[model samples]
Target chain A: MAHSSETLNPFENLRLELRRGCLVLAVLAELRSEQYGYTLRKALAEHGMAIDEGTLYPLLRRLENQGLLVSEWREEDKRNKRFYRLSPDGKLILKQLLAEWQSMNASLNGIF
Target chain B: MELLDRYLQAVKFWLPKAQKQDIIAELSEDICSQIEEKETELGRKLNEAEVEAILKQLGRPLLVANRYLPQQYLIGPVLFPIYRFVLKIVGLCYLVPWVLVWIGLMTFGLSDRAQHPSGSLIGALASLWGPLWLAAFFAFGVVTIVFAILERSQAKSRFLEDWDPRKLPPVRDPNQISRASSIFELAANTVFCMWWVGIRSPIIVLGQSAARITLAPAWRYFFWGFLFLAFANIATSGVNLLRPHWTRARASVRLVTDVIGVALFCWLCKAGILVEISIPTVAPAKTLEIANAINLWMSRSFPIVFIVGVVIAALDVHRIVRVKTADTRPLRGVAAAGGLPQQ
Candidate 1:
């Protein structure tokens, strides 16, 4: 069991790298509908794409920094919450990326 | 609410000053929502243990805060390998030598302390270690600062990209110059230079009170030459240790030193053993005959020594030019595994 765990480590690391690219795509795709951090995390988790709060928050900020997403703070449930949504640029990129993702998926399917 | 506030405060302490309030507010709202969701599921307000579990799940305050911070590196990934390389060289050149010097000082002190039982070995070690550690830290700081500047400027990555794979050192062969052998040569040469420098007279004592042969003044004249040869060997070895791939460079350096060594031997041969022997008044004539015979032997052996020196130098030159060319014949796929023997 310990040996299997040890061997799993490298695969786990590579899996994280694989998930990293997918996470950005998922976040961008979800934010097209506009949602706050907690709701966005919940929405993604419901769809079997669970992301940690730590990873989700930082990635949101980074995407915003890159001008692919825009964010605003507004009062919701008697408390101020920061809401994020895809920008015009992000929507354009999402379209292109989705196409790329589909093509890659198709190619992978053929191989498998 | 109180538990949530304390957790937020803990996290805020680690966040950047400019973003502290904004980040804390966002984080507080997220935690409250999570706790509310958990409470709805369990149908009760969370206890202290549940709150603690929630906070642990969020991760350590410092790590959570760090995720929000911009990625920072003193040496970025692009330049990290080179930075590590430079540090290793500095460690080899500075730290190793300093530690060796410290050990030498400690050995000398211990020997002295052997004479006087009251003397403290620990005190001697403490004194040397303090200064050596300070110097090592200073060197480390200087190298880090230099690399940090290079990183900030992004100048080194540009230089690194210009590197050619063809210039990569061939795979090392067992018989070729190695780090251990180079270090050994460097250390031996250093000790020889130190010994030569400290010598008041190069004396050869033959048995007990039989005869004492002191080298002539001509040996004194060649002190600088011998010292230079030793220093050259030391330097060549040092370079080889850092950049073992530069086989041609190592060969050239060895060739120059070998020529100098051969020249020094030729000078010694011309100077005729450079010695004066003194014998006791008892059996003075016989002792003088013995001394004359010894001198005659030295004169006869000089040519053989000179021939050997020439042969060694010639061999180094052949290895550098001919063997290197022969080995490089296959080119691309097959890199030469061996190099000239660096002795």
Candidate 2:
């Protein structure tokens, strides 16, 4: 017998929910260093947090729309590219998020 | 490359009109970058099959575009439960009653209605169908629209959050009757009592007797008995409202009252000539015949009241037995435990 793609695991659903919030935090942290869409994706993949392009692009646009990030279309490597970087608000938000994350991590470590 | 362009075009078609071009262009540039990296790895240009693999990994065009749109619903999640509740009430109060009455008329009223040209069973059912369907549709549509508007209005308001859990109704035991149903019964009994008192004289007067009928003189005697039963029902409803639970004593009272009611209605059924229609203008024989016809109608209806009363009385008996069994079971458990050694 073989497992098929249609087979669902409850653990996978829960893990996806856990990862969703982390992905937003990871994207904001990465945008501290300016990068184009492809390089940012490659960089995140290198760090072992692999987000698909569909989710990544929509999330980028959403974050930019919320004024946490800014983007510009410019010539890079002789091709038109949209570069993204953190805004002033993005830095402040990132600091708050990281503090919350660290406090939760410490508390979880203590409990475990 | 052509296949890639077509995929991007398909994705763009689903994207918002304002950002479609910009999104597609950015997506195209990213795909081209990935293809170039892959080619560099392979040490050669990639074929169509290789490109298609990359596209499949990226995701289907519709799914990718859908992610860009915010979630949408006719009635949003916040208002959905309330909307469902309102529909259920409509079903219970309006639709269920309508269906029951339709069934009753089909079962009983068909022969009486057959004198009319359009009163065949199928025709009567079809006539009911049109109104029932239209009424249900309109009821649902109106409720949906109201909730959709409410959803929009409450989206930014604290209407949901402002509610306190303490203000919510307390949980009740399954054995206990709901206060709402008890209140409804109380109101209904009160109405019946009032109608029983006032309807007699008006019915005898020909100014507005629809059936031109009169209750038999025996009903004048039967009235006090029926009114006693009505008061008993009202008293039980009040008891439930105050106590909000059933006990053996309460169940016994209900059982006794229902048995008395069944007896009273049975006495009324045996009472002579329950309905009369006297028309002085008509011939005396015709008047008696008219009176007999109404009497026949009343007699036909008597068995229904008897059956309903008997069912009510039987249910009360069942309830009383149940309460007794329930009362004894816990005590029996306690006694058994007392006999055992302490742990």
Candidate 3:
């Protein structure tokens, strides 16, 4: 079974790689509503895209690093929490990525 | 606290020791804040298990940290400095030897023909040229060494930065092993062996010997050696072209070629066919005797070394072939048992 699956594994891996860049866009779009890590994960999962906590946390940090997301620490009921929201730059980039995605999808759909 | 501690431990292991504490502090702060926000949303106190579960779902800490780390280049950052340093060192090493050899040769040339006035004068002038050439040669060596060192250092640094030690690919793939081409390997090894036999052995040995004997045309041997090396490189390129997927076979063939090359070099050293000037002085004779002893040791020991290298290479090739064969076995078995044609 594993032997037969090898043929398609590379193709599947490539498809995953193609989707990796879009992950940043997806995170930013979700964060526009002001959410924490677990909520974001749950939101993505609800949309049929389950992201591992391992993948999400670091991605959030990276987006924060790139100045696409703004984060703040808030304390409620004696518990400290960090909340993230989309930055102006993030919103602008999300718009661009969405337009690009739509155009590419249309072009690919036409060919297929 | 337990969830945060686990994440910190993972971060410390992944980051360099110098930066570990700082990174861990930052990560812990972020995780703590996130947990607080979640507890507030649920309208209850968070239990340790709930926090641990959330952290577990976050996946591996190293994977998360990698996303935040700065991108590093493979070759560009370090190569330049290392190349410069190596070039400088190589130039110096070559220069000193070249100058001494040139002076010694010129002095010998002049003394040999001292009784012939015009010949002696010509010999003295010619001797100076040898030393000058030696200096030039040393400079060239230094330049090349510096470049090579720089390139090597840069390659090492880039490899360290880009290559995730934890995520190393498998050492061997079955498909690659099975398809290893023996013909291409043999052809490459043959060409490499030919160059070692025909070009390098003769020039280095004959050139040194001829120089010692005050031969006027000995310098040509060095040129010949260079030409031969170039030809060998061209032959290697041709082999690469012919066997585009010969990487699997390369290690085995190279091992065999190295063994043959070392053997031939030892033989040439023993035969004295390459030596030019033989002086029967006690001290020089003792030096020659020492050289002979070393050569003898190499000649005797090399066969074992060569065999070992060849054996290892063969094993690697065999492993690859076995995997490839095994991969196709089930299909073949099914086809045979079912009386269906194999695809």
- Cand. 3 Cα-lDDT: 0.59
CAPRI class of candidate 3: incorrect
Candidate 3 lDDT tens digits, B1-343: 7666766787678776665764565456546656777888998878988888767765577766665566643334456456556566655555544444444334443333464445664556565666576667667666656556655775656554576677986444233323235455445656665665554333333443432332224334443544444455455445655543335345445444444544444344334342333444435666567656655554444434444444455665674465446546675454456544322
Per-residue lDDT over A21-83 for candidate 3, one digit per residue giving the tens place of the 0 to 100 score: 777778888988998666677788898677765567667877888899998767644645568
| Cα distance off (Å), candidate 2, residue B135 | 3.6
True contacts kept of each: 0.79, 0.79, 0.32
In TM-score terms, candidate 1 sits at 0.62
Interface RMSD of each: 0.7, 0.9, 4.2
Error of 1 at B66 (Å): 1.0
Error of 3 at B26 (Å): 7.8
lDDT of 2 by residue, B221-263 (tens): 6778778888999999999998877788889998998788888
Q: After superposition, how far is residue B254 of candidate 3 from its true place, in Å?
A: 22
Candidate 2 lDDT by residue in tens digits, A1-112: 2333236587886787788999999999999999999999999999988987888888999999999999999998888999999999999999999999999999999999
Residue range with the least summed lDDT across 10 consecutive positions in model 2 chain B: B334-343
List per-prediction Cα lDDT, in the order shown: 0.79, 0.80, 0.59
As a whole number from 0 to 100, the lDDT of residue B296 in candidate 3 is 54
DockQ per candidate: 0.71, 0.73, 0.21
Which 10 successive residues of model 2 chain A have the least lDDT summed? A1-10
Structure candidate 2, residue pairs in collision: none
- TM-score list, all predictions: 0.62, 0.69, 0.39
